[model samples]
Target: MLYIGLYLVAAGVGGIKGSLPTHGAEQFDESTPQGRIKRSTFFNYFVVCLSAGGLIATTFVVWIEDNKGWKWGFLISTMAMLLSIPVFLLGSGFYRNKIPNGSPFTTISKVLLAAIINSCSGKTTSNAVVNMATSPPSVSTQKSSDTKSKKGQEKTSENESLETQTQSFKFLNRAVNNTPVYTALKCTTKQVEEVKVVLKLFPIFASTIILNCCLAQLSTFSVQQAASMDTNLGSLKIPAASLPVFPIVIIMVVAPIYDHLIIPFAREITKRETGISHLQRIGTGLVLSVLAMAAAALVEVKRKNVAIKHDLVDSTKPLPITFFWIAIQYALLGSADLFTLAGMLEFFFTEAPSSMRSLATSLSWASLAIGYYLSSVIVSIVNEATSRGHHKGWLSGGNLNRYRLERFYWLLCVLGGVNFLNYLFWACRYKYRSTGSKK
Candidate 1:
């Protein structure tokens, strides 16, 4: 227990130090490859570590035995925090002495983070305008010849005017694509490159809702698994209330380690200027989530075997299954924090027109709301269908016991698979953009 506390403290300090760059403390641009990669790497590592740790802590809390296990988790967390004091000091050597007062990403992180887990309707609007402006002209030009004679000369002038109009519209579209609506327009290659980025980011944004839906199931359904599993800590009977500790401890500790170490190391190795884009990280995270669900489903199968051996037909009684299954779920789900939420944070801030940062952050939350609705709807449909049969429905609470839980797991698996495929399709088609003048 003491070792765990120490380890968590050390990791947490490291993570917080690394995350300072994004704490509204300093400003960085995504226009340059170096800048974007650097920001993306740090952000991704931070989120992944945080999520993984939180899950571990959650598992511990749920599985821990005793009346005061929750209090012990807190004690360890506090000590780990105290240990982080030196980490903060060490970080000062790498980060600037003072935090940056303002930047584009500061207020917008919330929106992107929210969008990662919620059904967002507004984020598409900004991209839509940019898309419209960049799309090719619908009208075709007619061929005309200029005459050296008087009549021919007049025709020549008309043709020149029409040519100029077409060019003007083309330039206008390019200009809109390159720069933010709020910024002064200049035609530059760098600006154009930024607009082109918008194209790359489209798929990631499209997947936002699906990711949200999957994540929403984590707390509600996954914890139920822990509750049903038995602990083998001798006479000490553990309750589910203390399971959240493991994930929380993991998050609080791992957050700093990845922030300071893994991110910087990866950036150095990859030679990516901006590190990795938020979209890439988020995509990776979505994949990890799918793996986590798969792990959970496997655990369910294991639990069934244990039940058979014990001759226990009661669904609610704790089975003699190992706790590692819960731990695996926590670890994998926690890792997602690095990619999904972090990517959303950076994406929303950078993609949004500067004025709507608040709105952008809020858009991410909409996915969570939508996910809840979707989960409920799916569960209701399944329950209705399976009522006459022995199958379990969506969101069914423990009545059918293992069978019902198994059914829910299968449902999530199917949903997550379909969602991931759709996300990939859109991700491939989307673009990334920056606010600047084109050369």
Candidate 2:
């Protein structure tokens, strides 16, 4: 029953996280600088609201579960979810809901299939039918059935083109042959370009997965490390689970400052609406994750050293080190999340084709889900490989104090560094759909 309920909750959250950001971001005008800046603000507050909810869950709901009962915790959580429905509905009249286009994935699949099938139909590939590569006909004009007058209008529209056909993804360009033996296999230049945009964004998506893998450590081993330390703050005894409150608080505080103060100053310096590009913001977060893992390693080393000094290596008692030491990593990772999560959300929404904005934005959450699973896989593999020859793996010991967590953190640090370099390569090569910079 508990597993069933958990699955239901996961379904609810998946629906909410994937749609809400795209819905909120699309409210503003995409054609203007002010609208773009305001959209950025929308994504920022979306993250802030999410953090606020997490804070409540970690502090209030957790307290209820611990001191009152699991029943009370469940009740409070259900009530909160119920209350949110009406609140969301109240904004319906004002919201800018996007009209549904046909499924984006279906279109993407059609383009790829058409590309593969028409790759070698050389008779159809000609400069004679139309120079679809250099001067593509608009989709609306093309759909009207090419009359002589409509053909003239298409030529006129081509002269006043907003975006030329890009040279990259040349293989997919075969999908857009000027003439084709099978009409069903013919793809429009717009369709081919949209697919190109999605393919280009994929590397950026893959890069963030490793950063989130670093974040997974905070919930798993970081909490365990905190539990082994002094959790007392003056007169109050804090639970190790409550350690997330530190990062939550940091997120809530930093988000507003970044939106209002930092962004405006960046605008002044860069002479652009987005003071820092989305990729640059995401890169900042990746750099911070590397720092976070490095900090976690050093802190673990210090904690282990203290345990050894106090002769508490094998003791079940808390180490003399403060749980606050773990907060340093939390704070760093929290800041990283603020940058990457919000930046990726806005970047995907802004850069994706209008029809695929929602689908592209969902990749932000997908990366997070993959990262967590990767973290577990990495842990298992590390244990299996290191525990060879009947030796204790770095993470295999029964005792948390005996575990070489410092070594584990350093491994993550190195992985994060390599991932950041990978991100830089993709980010530099990526051309913004709006700006059309090939580099």
TM-score: which candidate is best? 2
Q: Write the per-residue lDDT of candidate 1 for residues 189-267, one digit (tens) a residue.
A: 2223323333344445556666555555556666666766765557876555555555555555665666667666766
**Range of the 10 consecutive residues with the lowest summed lDDT in candidate 2:** 154-163
- Per-residue error for 118 in candidate 1, Å, reads 33
How many residue pairs in model 2 have overlapping backbones?
Answer: 0
What TM-score against the true fold does each predicted structure earn?
0.57, 0.89
Q: Quote the RMSD, in angstroms, for model 1.
A: 13.8
Q: In candidate 2, which residue ranges exceed 4 Å CA deviation?
A: 120-164, 177-185, 435-439
Cα deviation of 419 in candidate 2 (Å)? Answer: 1.0
Q: Give the TM-score of candidate 2.
A: 0.89
Q: Write the per-residue lDDT of candidate 2 for residues 33-104, one digit (tens) a residue.
A: 577778889999999999999999999888899899999999999998999899999999998887897888
- Model 1 TM-score? 0.57
Clashing pairs in 2: none
**Every candidate's lDDT:** 0.54, 0.85
Candidate 1 minimal-lDDT segment of 10 residues: 119-128
